[model samples]
Target: MSQQVQAVIAPGENEPVRVETIIVPDPGPGEAVVRIQACGVCHTDLHYKQGGISDAYPFLLGHEAAGVVESVGDGVTDVAPGDFVILNWRAVCGQCRACLRGRPWYCFDTHNARQRMTLASTGQELTPALGIGAFAEKTLVAAGQCTKVDPEVSPAVAGLLGCGVMAGIGAAINTGQVGRGDSVAVIGCGGVGDAAIVGSRLAGASKIVAVDIDDRKLETAKSMGATHTVNSKETDPVEAIRSLTGGFGADVVIDAVGRPQTYRQAFYARDLAGTVVLVGVPTPDMKLELPLLDVFGRGGSLKSAWYGDCLPSRDFPMLVDLHQQGRLDLGAFVTETIGLGDIEQAFGRMHGGDVLRSVVVF
Candidate 1:
């Protein structure tokens, strides 16, 4: 039987998301129905509402979520009913070229529930954001999309592993390969940037410099483990980072803002043979122009992180364990807890730089 649940939906471009009744169908083969316990409000959800992602209208906009499996369809054995899981967008297909090459994180094909949830009133099909529409009481997703984790953790904190937090931590640990005693600089101190700082610290980075235009964000970054903070509005970030790192540059520089200018800052603010990891999502029209000589002179890796190049099966459980052991402060990322109806308002607060994460808790 189809279940009727109140969900958050972006009806059109730049439209305010409304709480509407949507029909979630019974899970089919390889799928499961999840009773959402908590979902984090992320910038990506705002991008979806603003038509930045795609023209797919009436989008079901929440993705970073943790929930309990209420039911499973035929052939779904990875997860069973009553299991606590963190929803991940990337459900790797083991047969893909990337997976065959032993890098499933770059899986060419990811899976989502084949079924669609419809608007109960109009019967219009709702596009699940990132293949895991989660701002509802319950959602349907591929069984692989649900990674079972320790149920003792708070849902609000666990759900963040689904996206932004995972992206940031992965950018530093997996992509940048931050190591002990290395100097690291992270540009843009939002949730992602801050998480990178935390990851770098966990990796034993000796000098962690955070650069951001907002002093407020920089202050937050300091609490997250940054040893130094640079206000880009007052100084050149590349120069400041270089100055902080003995007139050289950081061993690893992460560009979390995903802007061309920030990309250049990261490119130039790295030591010789240092790594520059671009974890930020850039738009199509955005372009980068750097001197060919400078590119050669940098002599290091230039990489982009997709979902932090994280393998959900491996990373989520370990991170949760770290959080449980009090070694990683995942709960620090949760700035506020909100109801489902307040998601639209949370977006505005996010844009205004008021909170790190405003999670929707059911």
Candidate 2:
């Protein structure tokens, strides 16, 4: 039997999100229904509402989530009912070319529940944010999307590993490959950038400089293990970063803001042959122009991090265990907890830069 549950949804472009009852059907083969414990409000959710992601109206908007596996359908063997798990967007298919090459994290074919969630009032099928609509009390997803972890970890903290937190950490460790004693500079001191700082510290980077336009965020970045701070709004960040790195520049510079200006700053702010990682999302119409000579002269990698290029199965459990062992401060990223009804208010608070994340808790 189908069950009705309240969920946060954007009815149309630029519309405010509201709690509406939606129909969740029983899981089919390879699917699972989760009883959501917590879900984080992410910028991607805002993008979905603004139609930045697509013109898919009536979007079910939440992805950074953790929950208990309430039930599983036929062919689901990895997770059972009552298991604590973090929901991921990428459920890799082993047959894909990337998976065939042993890089399942880059699997071209990720999985989502084949069933459709419908709005009870109009029977309109809703598009789930990131294919994992998790704003509701219960959500259906592919069994492969659920990565079981320590049930002892707080759901709010564990939920973060579902998206932004994992992206930042992976941006450093998996993509940028920041090593021990390497100097790293992260542009943008938001939750993702701060996570990059945490990852850099964990990797034993001797100098981690955090760059942000907001002084408050810079201070918080310090708490997240930033060894140096740069107020990009007040000073030329490239010069500041270079000055901090003994005029040679950092080994790795990550642009968490994802703008032309920031990318250019990241371009010139690194030492010769130093890697530059672009982790921040860019608008579709956004374009970049760099001097060809400069690109050749830089002589290093310029890479974009898609969800930090993470493998949910390998990364989620290790990160949760690290947090449980008092090494990773996952709790610091959660600034406040709100109910599903408070999503609009939380969206308003997102730009304030003080709140790292406003999580929706059931």
Candidate 3:
């Protein structure tokens, strides 16, 4: 049976997102239907609305979500009805070259529901934001997209593990490989940057410096485990970071802001043979200019982290357990909770830097 539910949709480029009736069809082979309990308002959703992601219009936006499994199609043995799960965009196909090489996290072929969700009034197929359209009351997705976790955790916090939170943490722990006593500097104290601080602390980093223009966000970074904060507006962050690390740049510098200037800051703010991780998404028109000699002289890796090189099956459950044990503070990331119709308002708040995350709770 096809279920008609209220969902948020971006009808066209630069159009405001609004709630409308949409038809979610029954799961086909290797698919599942989820009743979403909570979904976070991420910048990626905003990018989709602005047509920065693709030409796909009338996008069903929202991907960072947690919910209960309502039903499953044939051969969907990983999850069943009534199970609690976190929605993920990466659904690894074991036969892919990346997966066969034992790096399933880089799986080239990810799974999404074959069936399309259509607008109720127009009968037009709606493109999902990132293969998972989760702003709706109920959503259809690939069975592999559902990662089961303990039902005891709050859906708002757990949903974040699906996207930005995971990306930030993974940038520090998985991609940057922050180790004990290492000095780490994260540029941009947004949700992603703050998560890098927390992840660095969790990995036993001795000096964690956070750089951002907003003093309020810097304060929040301290609460998330930053040992020092640098207001980039007041001082040169590269010099500040170097001064804090005994006048030798940090062992690892992560650029979360993803602009040309920040990228250069991150490049120059690392010690010789130190790693620089670029986790920030850059615009297509942006061009980077670096000295070829410096690239050779730096002598360390310059890597771009895709989804933080994360393996969902391994990271999600472990992080949830850490949250349960009270070792990780997942709740700190959620600043507020809004309703389905309030996505536009939440986007404005995000743009204004008033909140880290404004989750929509069902």
Candidate 4:
């Protein structure tokens, strides 16, 4: 049977999201219905509202989420009812070439619920953001998208592992391969960059430098384990990063801001054979230029950290356990909790730079 539930929706391009009644269908084979508990407000959601991601209007806009599985369809042996889980956008298909090669994290064919949620009023199918939209009271998703985790952890904190948090930490450990005694400089003090700091600290980095225009964010980065803070607005970030690392630059430099200028800084800010990780999202129109000789001479890897090169099944549960053991503080990423209706204001707070994350708690 289908069910009617209240959900937030972007009705059109650049349209302000408003509450609407959506019809969620019963799970089909290989699908599950989740009663969402907490969903984080992320910049990607904002980009969806502005039509930056696609022309697919009326997007169901929430991806970073956690919930309880209310039910699962036939053939879904992995997850059963009453299980606590964090929703992930990547639902890997094992038969893909990448998966067959034992690199499922790079699975080319990720998926979502086969059924579509529709507007109760007009029955128009709504596009689920990242295929795991959880801004609603409940959402249907493919069974593979739900990764069971420790129920003891707060749903609010667990939800963060779904996206930005995972991306940042993955960028550091998985993509950049940060290790003990390594030096890391994260360019950007937002939630993602801050997570990179935490990851570096966990990996036993000897020094962690945070570069950002805002002092407040830099301070937050410091509290999260940054050993040095550089106000890029005042100083030449590339030079400062080198100075902080004893003039050799860091072993790994991550650009969480993803802009041409920041990328250039990252390119030049690393040691002669140091790695540069780009985790920040950039617009399509943006272009980058660097001397061909420099690219060839850098001698190290330049990587774009896609969802932090994370494998959801492996990383999510491990991170949850880490948090439970107090080795990871996932709660710090959540600045405040608000009701679903407050998402609009939460978006405002996000842009105002007053909050790291404003989570919608159901």
Candidate 5:
């Protein structure tokens, strides 16, 4: 059996996402059907619409979602009907080399639901965004992709742990390995950047610096645990970060805005031997032209954080527990909650930097 539901779809490049009727199939083997309760509007969704991700037209959008499992297919044992879960895109295949080596987070063969949701008419098939489209009443995903979490928290809050929040927090704690009393700087004050600030604070960083072109986001960063803010428009950010860190740059500099310029700034904003983490999503055409000598002279690791180096099974529960304890302040990320129809407007707000995260609540 299949279910008919309304979902946001990117019909073509630069076209506004439309809410249309989408047909979601029953869970196939190793799959489960989830009745989505909430999903966050991440920048990745906008990328999908801009043809930045792919030309997979009529793409079923929304990935960072949380909901209750409605049904499970044959051989599905991880989650049963009635279980609440946060949908994860990376469902590790234990046989993959990364997983076999005990690093499931880097599993190269992460799986998704084998069946594709599609348009009812013309028998046109649609590509599910990030393999877990949830901007609808329901979404189908690989059973392993649904990580069961405590259901006590509102779905709106729980859903964020699926993406941006995880990226930001994990970039600092996991990838950057920020330690207590360390000085951390996050370039770009968007959702991912602000989450990095919060993560630094949670990791006990003594000084958290936020750099951005927008003053509003800088203010938002402060509220999220930044000890200082730098409006890059009016000052040299790398120098300011250096001065703020007492003649040495931050111990960890994160480029949350993935661009060559910001990447350059992040490279120059960290102290010698300090780590520089790139958590930003960059364009395919964007190229780095740094001197090979400088790259070698940096004396530190230039790393790109894939999904914040998050391990769904390990990080999700621990972060949820932190949120439950009221110490992590995950609520700060929710600027507004809107219905599925407000997604287009939310994307505008996201580009305008007016909201941290506009979540769609089903």
Candidate 6:
């Protein structure tokens, strides 16, 4: 039987998304249908509407989401109906080379739903954003994509682990390897950057500096665990970071903005033999042309964090538990909550730096 779901669909480039009735199929083998409770309005969704991610028009736009499994198809085992889960884009194929080598985080093959969700009226195939479109009442995903977690926390908060939150925290804990007494610097105090700051604090970093052009976001960063804040608009961040780190620089500098300028600042703002982690999503036109000697002179790893190098099965539940225990501030990241129809306005708010995350609550 087909399920009728209210989905946010971007029919063409730069077009406003419409909430339309979409036909969701019964789950196929290894697939499960989740009744979405909440989905965050991330920048990626806006990018999809702008034709930045792909030319696949009539795209079902959403990814960061959490919900309860409504049904399961044949051969599904990891999740069953009634289980609460956070949807993950990277459903690791354990038999892949990266997984075989014991690094499932870099799984070469990830899984999505076998069938496509389409427009009910036109029967037009709608490409799902990041393979998990959860702006609807229900969406289909691979069984492996649903990572079960505690149901005590609101889905509005738990769903965040599906994306940006995971990216920020994982960037610090996984890519940066921030440790006790380490000095860490995060550029761009958006949701991801703030999450990095929180992660740094969680990892026991002694000094966490947050750099941003906006004073308000910097202040929020302070609340999230940034020991110091730099208004990058009025200051040279690289120099400010060095001053804060005793004229050396932070042991780790993260470019959460993912621009050439911010990346350059992060590149030059780290202490010798320190790491520079890029977790921000950059546009294709944006290019970095730093000196070759600088890359070698740094003497530390230059890494790009993909979804914060997170293993959904390992990180989501643990983080959810942390949130439940009040160890992590997942709730703090949610600046505002709205219905699915508010996504387009939420995109504007995101662009205007008005909110950290505008979650769509079903």
Estimated TM-score per prediction? 0.99, 0.99, 0.99, 0.99, 0.98, 0.99
Q: Which lDDT value does model 3 have at 198?
A: 89
Candidate 4 residue lDDT tens string, 169-219: 999999999999999999999999999999999999999999999999999
Q: Candidate 1: worst 10 consecutive residues by lDDT?
A: 297-306
C-alpha lDDT values of all predictions? 0.96, 0.94, 0.95, 0.94, 0.92, 0.93
**Model 3, 40: alpha-carbon shift in Å?**
0.5
- Model 4, position 107: C-alpha lDDT score: 91
Q: Candidate 1 residues 27-107, lDDT tens each?
A: 999999999999999999999999999999999989999999999999988899999999999999999999999999999
Any residue pairs clashing in model 1, and if so which? Answer: none
lDDT of 6 at 317: 88
Give a tens-digit lDDT track for model 3, residues 83-174: 99999999999999999999998899998999999999999999998999999999999999999999999999999999999999999999
lDDT of model 1 at position 252: 98
Considering every candidate listed, which one attains the maximal lDDT?
Answer: 1
Superposition TM-score, candidate 2 onto the true structure: 0.99
Sorted by lDDT (best first), the order is 1, 3, 2, 4, 6, 5
List the candidate 2 regions with Cα displacement exceeding 4 Å.
Answer: none
Poorly placed runs, candidate 3 (over 4 Å): none
Over 4 Å off in model 5, which ranges? Answer: none
Give the runs in model 6 whose Cα sits over 4 Å from its true position. none
Which has the better lDDT: candidate 2, or candidate 6?
A: 2
lDDT (Cα) of model 2: 0.94
